[model samples]
Target: MENRKAIEAGQDITMQKEDFAALWKTIHLKVTDTYEVPPEILWVNGSTIGTLGNFSASTGKAKSKKTFNISAIVAAALKNDEVLKYSAYLPPNKRKILYVDTEQSKYHCHKVMERILRLAGLPTDKDRDDFVFIVLREQTPDKRKQIIGYMLENMPDVGLLIIDGIRDLMYDINSPSESTDLINLLMRWSSGYNLHIHTVLHLNKGDDNTRGHIGTELNNKAETVLQITKSQQDGNISEVKAMHIRDREFDPFAFRINDNALPEIVDGYVFQQPKQDRNFPLTELTEQQHRKALENGFGKQVVQGYSNVIAALKQGYASIGYERGRNVLVSLNKFLVNKRMIVKEGKGYRYNPDFHY
Candidate 1:
């Protein structure tokens, strides 16, 4: 009643200055005294995609298997399994995954689900309440956003969310303001929920870049951006390259649909052959050679310096130049370090042979 009387008198309709300060003090922190260990919350192709509250994107041309790649990621996250020969963050309590497909018919989407289940090694007949798949081809732009917003708000356990057709969420991909707004919403949702969000985008038909202003904005804001492209050497193979990454980027890897119609990495696959010239940098070696060196180095199971590792690589292939060999050795060492296949020692590193590729 007293508060009502004060309001009726038209004195200070807004919150009082002292009350606002009290509310601010509840959440304020001392900058120098505050410290926190970053969360380990992202994984793709066995590499750390990023920490929590980060967004990543995958882009490809039509029929480039962009959806399939993301499906593999979803499978890994849900089953706490590996995908494309890479490990993922497997929480003690498996968290729910929400996959929203804005394009594709119901029939095609079901096939995607089957492929994901197969990759996760889960039976198709089993009940999967933890993984939710929503096909929203008919939903309006506004409606789709509303539904996604509701899910994010109500389902606190959803640790991973994949939007297959992220471009459809905005009415105009060419509009800078619209694209900025959509990305802002995604960034806000990701940070607010402490979740990782992956979105799929289509690349320009004639160019390697993603389509329109929206793609540009997404690339700018995303912590990791993967590019999927049909191999020029073979039509059956699709190459996935980490175009931009905040952390260490893995070498480009290729996959093809197996007899089971699932995406599987081709072991010993070489995306491209290096130019046959002594002048060519060792860094330009084929993906196969890189993997071979990495496997050989890790096979030793002993602490090895970079020079010794390069010597071992040259033993497998005599064509590697001294500088080129060192480059390859360093690259593979970084990759293995990031993948947790090896640990750095005093002026050397020890490889873990038991670590699965």
Candidate 2:
């Protein structure tokens, strides 16, 4: 109430006189202080990636399986065990997880809930108070933040808060003031409630950087920033790496969506090509190799569009355990067409079954 009055009286909160009474309660610094470090709620290889009262983000391009990685994190929090090398240890008193989704329909949000439950090995049909899921897809940005604040206040036991699609909380992601304000809110909410907040954002198109001014602020202030990207070798696989971290960086890892639509680690998976040598020229394929590639890439259906052709060929090459980078994949597509291996029929390209292969 006093703070409200001060605001009404045109007082800036930061410039106001010190609240000496609250100093000791808020700060623990002393020359001889022996406070233990904050406990970690999320870990990779036994190294802390998420500590209480801090925020982190995961960013990727569109359809890069970012949500799948986040699902594992949320499931680990609920199960209090390791999921995809991410483990969470919410104190018994603070076992609740509050997941706020701002971009998906309610049905899709429900599907996400089901996915989390399944990943945690919990019954999907049962409702649990400790796991709260909410969708703000219809709400205005201001209202969405307001509702989240209200929910957080009411759910004091929440140990982990996830703001999936954090971009949706702002009217303009490019606004510098908005970016700073939003990041400040994250700091306040996380510290005020003594909880860890995990957020998700999309990478800028054609680049690895997170989107907008808000992304810049997030990188500067976040406890950790993780990047997820579709493997250049196989688009179906997503590799997660630490973009920024406060602790020792963990080894990069990859996961692929399985038949069950759940992400599973690609166990002992090795990429044939090194990252620095991705642009190496494509080697000529033998006639038998060409035949197999056609069988795997196009099968029977012929795709006319350029974008569609590249996608089909990627899956085809990956199916035959052939590692082809994006550039190489494009080159191989032209190579086959030029070699008369895949003949152009009308407007579409079709594999010639009897082209002297």
Candidate 3:
């Protein structure tokens, strides 16, 4: 009512042409010649995983070694070396990489830092100026985003940004609106800063897919998506495959946790063997069949052994299950070797598909 009375009293309430033009000038305009292809910073299996001005994602089940694999990538970027036999090209004139952990505790985050440094061949005694690690486990979603934005804007030397727990930045992972907003923010940050942003996500337990709408949106927006899975034959080993890529598909690779607590690519690792008509399709078995197979004597023995190896890898000997499991696995491996069902390979044993367990 007061605004109406003011207008009636001849107040100037209309947008002026000069004011409108000033606002219009804020929009950036560029010619076609000014545009160029985004530079690829990280490559895996002939596919580009990290490209400047774009985003990528890595997802897997809990304790599937998603973070561990990412640590290897970060190490490669820092050292300007190859990761999993793929070249990691550093951004021009940039030597910094920022890693943000929003889920792990301070001690765990410190362990991650140590692992990255060790894998990158850096001495732990001296502080690193090129790599920045931030832990925001106690921060709210809003505060975390604020801090990330501030860092991206201020840290001009940081060419790569890693979000270890991307779900922490969203209020609800299943909300489509929230997922959309989160992806938009990520795109903006990647393009505005002209850097690569890699995010880690959790997968749904019941199936080999990411959690919710957030995962769907991320898969769509990401230029590359890497899926990490625990090996059924050897729980200590994790297989990483490029699930989606903007370019050509990359071959899969496998890695295992070394004694130094760093992920090392398994030597002469074969992801899968050639299909033979006589060989049973163990990899293509149904869920029910998988469960039933684990219930039988040999299957049960092998499964229990793998479980113990996984436990030892994750929790060490703190649990009696690890020791018991390892003993059972050793016995079972020997029996399988005698039967020719499994053969010893580089650092581990490989299952023979020709023989049914």
Best by lDDT: 2
Total clashing pairs in model 2: 0
**How does each model score on lDDT?**
0.74, 0.84, 0.75
From the highest lDDT down, the ranking of the candidates is 2, 3, 1
Candidate 1 on 161-268: residue-level lDDT in tens? 889999999998888789889999998888888778889999898866568888767755787888888888888888888766767677788899889888999778
**Which run of 10 residues does model 2 get worst, by summed lDDT?**
273-282
Residues 1-357 of candidate 3 have per-residue lDDT tens digits of 998988877746677899889967656575743657898899986678889889999999988999999998998898899755556877666678999999999999999999888888889888888899999999999999999999988988778899999999999988878888999999999988888999999989997657777887776578888899998778999998876667776788899987877788897776665343333333454534433332332321332345543342223222322233444444433444433354323223344444433
Query: Would you list the rank order by TM-score, best first?
Result: 2, 3, 1
Residue pairs clashing in model 2 are none
Clashes of each: 0, 0, 0
TM agreement with the true structure for every prediction: 0.69, 0.71, 0.69
The candidate scoring highest on TM-score is 2
Clash total of candidate 3: 0
Better of 1 and 3 by TM-score: 3
- Model 1 whole-model lDDT (C-alpha atoms): 0.74
Q: How many residue pairs clash in model 1?
A: 0
